[model samples]
Target: MANQTPESNQPSNTQTYGFPIYAADWIPEETVRSKIDKDQDNSEDVGGESSSSTSRSCIVLAGGGGEGRSGIKNVIVICRVDLDTKSLAEQPLGRIVLGTDLPYRMAVHPRGGGLVCALPNSCKRFDWESIISPREGDQGGEEGEEVINELKDVGQQLALAFNQEGSVLAAGGEDGTLRIFEWPCMKTLLDESKAHASVKNLTFSESGKFLVSLGGPLCRVWDVNASAAIASLSKEKDEMFAYCRFSVDNAGNEVLYIAANTERGGSIITWDTTTWKRRRSKLMKNYSISAFNVSADGKLLALGNMEGDVLIIDSTKMKTHQLVKKAHLGLVTALTFSPDSRCLVSVSFDSRAKLTVIEKTPEKRKGSKLAGDVVVVRVAIRGFLLFLDGKGDHRQRK
Candidate 1:
């Protein structure tokens, strides 16, 4: 669990819960990095870059081709920010071009050792240093013909995830199989076909003791070492569970959350890990859930709906704490909290990702909604050009 900081700077959030319930006016952060736009091979286009900077976190965004883009393939964008100024670096860290197929899941190593992503053909790992600062004539690990000769015969790429320690990576695909490899080494460990008809998502328990896979007909929890199923769930109502995760309790117990889109909309189901039995089942929304993620500390869960709305749920109570409707022009594709729990980042199919700060507030429990006051604030991306404009000539586009 993450340590909670003092909330003395803002008023007590006893009225609206701790959620940044309101979207304040947007303000852009000042940056010292330059931006770049380039065309390559008359086949694909690449965008977004940073000049240089010292920053604590970088966001990796995956998007398919868009306007003024020639290729149908997915493009990778890396954005680095000062984190202190709550602003972007003058430029981006870098970008990776994966041809023809749409890119999906991405996993960055905790120690910055490497990055693993689902390519159009295969899931590949790359050294971070190589990606950020490539040598002349080098395209990193997942670029060009280098990746073509590796990670073959796996069928279509589907899901990707790394364990807490980043020592192991798991990937699922169209072949109803699951593959686990040892870190940057990419050594084959367990290759189990029949993990399901096809896995919609892949995840590891908090302790990395169990691997969970969700499918249309069944969900299985596997013992990582033995590579065997410890528990299996088949719910008729939930034809599929596209999203699931393992969160920790105060006593350090792992709690499992599973959700799916039903006929009416979506259903959220949770299980007690110790008992491996269903704990709660509830209809969360009238629209299908597109993407959702739990905070690293397991305190908050942010869910996006097909209608482009985002709802913040209290992890403990499994109830809505705040609602931000119409969050995106199109459906949300991904949303998760920064490692420090200070920022919530969300990306959409519309080819955009936005970052919002999480302010300090009181902890609210289940039952009747608590009346609390929350301080709402909104900050724009792209160097936050609005707020710090004309302050200094430190900002420019490359």
Candidate 2:
């Protein structure tokens, strides 16, 4: 979808200034509904609607905050959209809100029905709310009981990745500390103390056994289950590693990858996760790399830079597959792929998130085909990204 214009109040049709900075609240309800419906249709149209298919779900990132002062509320939810008949299949189900007062980051538990969010400035832990039945308007309070509250400081700046089964949640912080937690309990399972800097991004291999943490100049690999540090990768140059991903090969082994920003510009590095062995590293010809993602099948890597542009790389062959410019406006912050791996969703400072559906050619279908089944929902948050998920323990009522 394009940026919205002022007079029209409709998303801007033309890409004027690279990243359009508008209020996320400007996205109208009708537009969200339309985007959801368009995403639900299975026909092969780039931007067309088709017959309704099965129910669809999505993980959304709600982020906004400036420095020591909290400009945006600490409210962020990984919303799970339920689709039916080109319309909302059900009210969007999400976790409890983190409140608007905190500077936080969140991640969808690798497994379904769970999530992890953390405060960047403090040593606060995250809690998990058990799965309860969805109520009218997608409310969860009407049904189940509250679970448990756990606390663990995730140091400055945090990012998380879940194991394949979603059983374990791995959190990395700015202090270069990496912690692993078991689901439900939110108990710390493992902590890697050697990392000295804050972690910017991370991900798990498809096998769920290995975890990769991007520490900019330094990269560390861990065995999530064993909670052991397996290997470390770094660059002699003092480039800040901005993003890192663990892409699995056909053998289920972890292949490490990182995008670093340097004085010269930006570059991407790939290594063997198991051995900390270097595979290939390349400096981006243009566009400063901001964030990147690896497809579940381990075939494609999507990279976004400061220019709101995206570069798709073939991991196995180690080559650039496709490069998309103006992928999003403003600073490209985060990226993720659907379980099926056909669609890529990118969020940016432009105050808008974009869903780029890649039409997988026959050669690209290494795994599931989600292109024809992908749908995009326009997420708009007013005031702040409400974190309470509203399903609080009313029983814990004072």
Best by lDDT: 1
- Per residue, candidate 1 scores C-alpha lDDT tens digits across 225-330 of 8877889977765445778888886667788888777878777788899888988876775768888788888888888876778777777777777777776666
Please provide TM-scores, in order, for all candidate models, with all chains considered together.
0.71, 0.66
CA lDDT of each candidate? 0.61, 0.55
Tens digits of per-residue lDDT for model 2 on 1-398? 12335674322212221222211111112323434444345222753433333445544444444332643433333333333321211222233333332434555544334334455454333322322122254222412322224333334556766676777777677777777788756788886665646776777776777777877466777777777877877675757777777677776766777778777777778776546778777776545777777877878888778778877877777677776778765577666666666666666777555555655556556334554334212233421344444435453573
User: By summed lDDT, which 10 consecutive residues of candidate 1 come out lowest?
Assistant: 18-27
Model 1 misplacement above 4 A: 1-56, 66-73, 82-91, 134-150, 236-239, 363-398
Off by over 4 Å in 2: 1-51, 65-74, 77-98, 120-157, 192-194, 250-253, 361-398
Lowest summed lDDT window (length 10), candidate 2: 20-29
Candidate 2 whole-model C-alpha lDDT, 0 to 1: 0.55
* lDDT value, candidate 1, whole model: 0.61
